[model samples]
Target: LEGADGPGLFNAAQTLRQLVTRESSKGKGSKGDKGSRGFAGVTVRDWPASPVRGITEGFYGDAWSQQERLEQLDFLGRTKQNRYLYASTDDPYRQSSHWRDPYPAAQRAEFRALAERARRNHVTLGWAVSPGQGLCFSSDEDRRALLRKVDAMRALGFGAFQLRFEDVSYSEWHCDEDARTYGSGPKAAARAQAELANAVARHLSARHPGTEPLSVMPTEFYQDGATDYRSALAEKLEQGVQIAWSGVGVVPRTITGGELADARSAFRQHPLVTMDDYPVNDYAQDRIFLGPYRGREPAVASGSAALLSNAMRQPTASRVPLFTAADYAWNPKRYDPEASWEAAIDAVAAGSGTEEAREGAREAVHALAGNDASSLLGGRESAYLRPLLAEFWAAYDAADSDKKSEVKRLRRAADQLLDAFGTMRTARERVPDALEREVRPWLRELARRGEAGEQAVKMLTAQARGDGGAAWDARLALKQLRADGPERGAVVGKGVLADFEKRALETSERWAGVRRKAFGDQTVHGGPTARPDSPAEAAVDGDPDTAYRA
Candidate 1:
């Protein structure tokens, strides 16, 4: 807390978490009143170990622009996130200022409008100004550019600036690379960089009178475990300037152990900003959490959901960090990786009458939104698979011929499979209002269990990361839960409705397995794999249709 730019500040925020009532966390997402608050007399506890627990925007090219950035800022605020890293190639307003283009007449006005909206929502916007990279500023020029940028931000009302020192000399805005580089040694280089950056900080504070914090992106070479550059940078992290680390496992689209280790090392020096880790690779593509741009495409939505889910799973401890889902101008590096599908579902389900009705609607809608096994099983059975049988055969014939139509033939197979799955939407749409009402209770219970189950895992992991005694206690609690699985399992000793809920949650959990099984059934995609001999043989005896149809 002395300088207010270290882990201590982060610790203070964590302590603040315990001070907050449990109602806050649950209010964010917990269904009904049954949450951390319900279980005990509300004891809140949270702390971020890193200074910047964040995500970025404006990296993945021109895919995300002004409007998308605003929306993502709102989303970050809802999650209690505290930072925004704007790394776009082209400025939002398409103009430039020396140090920073005084928000320009157009850009400044845009920022002010965005700031008004952000302020209303309790979001503090941070700027990641990269003068050296895109601005073509030399070391001397950088001094001036920094001043201009700071002045511009000050004029527009911003308190923090992330100084990104990326060296891009090949482009049109290229500057003498060495003149702007952070140099070889961390100290000497840092000393020089700090002098320049500190001047900007001082100038901004003096000029704006409300100077925000500054975070400098560390040199890329610091990836080495024991490098002088890192040590110098750590030592030279000027009084007000923090360090930001690039999440490099991206690009190729991977977050490996080595990358995390490097991050931990750099974090030990000072709080670091994490970039390019959002819109997680749900489909395991190189790009993760890279976009929520140009409106909602289903593929993008699903991909964003996957990335958000993955980002949620990371054990990041940065305190004052931000997350963006915007793929600015289509640059993968600056994609906001925080989009919550679960939250989205909850949003859609809000105000849909009773809780049960809301939940039933959620499932139905989810079914329509996907092509997985769970979607297929939403209503009745696989009667639609029969129609695609001929198309499937044609794909097989195409595949066998020595024709050069491999991609097309494979695409044909995929189309037929999708055609079969499309039946889910038809069935979901046909679901009667009476049936929805009938299934409402089961759906609510299912949603509750699914959510609670995931939270239980998170809670245990959280406890494990805490003090030893608490960790041990959490361990025992998990063991007890496991032992009580028979009773704990949603369907165990339950009625027919309870059984259905259990299957639904399980199917959702094993979505991939369900998908494989659906295609692995008596179909061409089932190719060579042993198909379920009697998958559609209906149920076991006694009015099979009534078992699910009713």
Candidate 2:
């Protein structure tokens, strides 16, 4: 706020649980009193390590609702994110088909409202246009169309702009003028793109004056090192125009400073902006990534001009990872992903109903994030459950190999696993409804797997007690639960939990002398069905598409 590149501020209130403290006098206190219960003044010097740290709505999926965008802006502000870029692939007004058309009145009104909300939150609204599919770069008419579109959007309060050439051709020409002005090849395309980018960026500097610099997503936005196209663009593109890259890969598992240096070398003199693609789930729409942001070196934050993370379709659900990303961007030197992760869960769960309900929501969210933590970032699925499962097996093995130990050890382990399953099964009901709606599919799957897990534990525990009758009944109930659908819907507790159920059921079926599959022919218990033919063998399916009343 002081100069062209002055310090910025982000007051992230969502993570106040991190700052929460219980104070009482130290040493030899009453058993109930932990610390002096009083507020203490503190001086916290908070600042972002990266200049531009935020998220981009650039996923290829259904466009987010206007209200969703408003919530996202608030989230960004509360998470210390200072920028939000609008670049959904599905938005036609910003695409090649309609890059020049003014937004419809209803949409224009929505954009203005979004801008005001962003301004209130101190978020700089940024927009990106993808006009590479049919743009004749050499044509004066096309250039004017783009500028006019930018002018209208600038009037609506967008503070930054980006030209996206990621989806454009490298060797083909769209028009006769483009072919004559720029020859066929990657280098020629890069030269033409540089010509346009420099002009637009220079225009922004001259006309907008104090607005943020323009950025461009090059044709090789995700590649490693220099190339004919990258070199050409690097040599010819304007110095102040930022080059946006998605690390060494489109969504690299980890971005190190060495890679950033490589990227800078490739882009030459232009300032580099890193568009990190995490959490966005268009490629795997059934799941949401709720893991902590990690595998990035500290220099990745310090070196980039701006670091923008990509978001998922579910706006509220994206906040967990986004919150951690902001923490890393704010101070990568002191970042602790696991600690930041726990804080993120508490932050998001803080809004759930009453005190008791908020506590429940926190537990539910923590359990959910643990189970759903695996992503392209590549970590163990069900990280929390893994240790519990391992403990159960170890206790069971100890009890089996030596016959004199307390069965309490085995039961205790099983109970812990069951409690974890119970949390997963009921998390949806406990969390905020807005979050519940976004994750219903995945949560239901988690519940199904949890139920199956409960039955599996019952089966094994009964076998441990030498109750053949009880073991058989538990196995049959598990079979019935499996019939209700264990393999349906979104993925949760993917490899670890499913493997436990499979191995448990297999061991149950292979029991030395227990009877299995004892069901006989069925008969109707009540006269309720309108169609007698479909009565006892049928199910009252909830899905209307598959259910016929008759």
Candidate 2 per-residue lDDT over residues 1-550, each given as its tens digit: 1222322433634334234422221221467654444446665646678988999999997888998999999888777678999998888999989988999999999999999999887889999999888699999899989888888999999999999999898877779889898888999999999998887887788788867999999999999999999999989997788999988887789989999999899888578989999989888876789999988999999999999999998888899999999999989999998888887898788777665787899888988888889898886789989889999888866666245455878988999999998998898888778889988888888887888888888888887876767776777777777777754548887788878987887665444221233237532221243244542212233211111121
Candidate 2 global CA lDDT score: 0.81
Each model's total of backbone clashes: 44, 5
lDDT of 1 by residue, 1-550 (tens): 2324443344444335423433343454556644343224433343332323335554333334467567655555544445555555455422233444444587678787767766654445666665544453345665675676566665565656666564423223344464455333445454555565667666766776654566676555235354655665566555546565434533323434455456546544454444543343223321112122212222322222112211311111010112223222122333332233333334433445654566555555343222111110021112223334345435543443345575366456545544333333233333334333423332333333333333333332232233334433433443354444432211211232223224423332221112223435332222233234522222222222211221
In TM-score terms, candidate 1 sits at 0.46
Angstrom error of the Cα, residue 419, model 2: value is 0.6
For each candidate in the order shown, give its overall lDDT on alpha carbons: 0.41, 0.81
Most TM-score-accurate candidate: 2
Write down the worst ten-residue block by lDDT for model 1.
Answer: 312-321
TM, every model: 0.46, 0.88
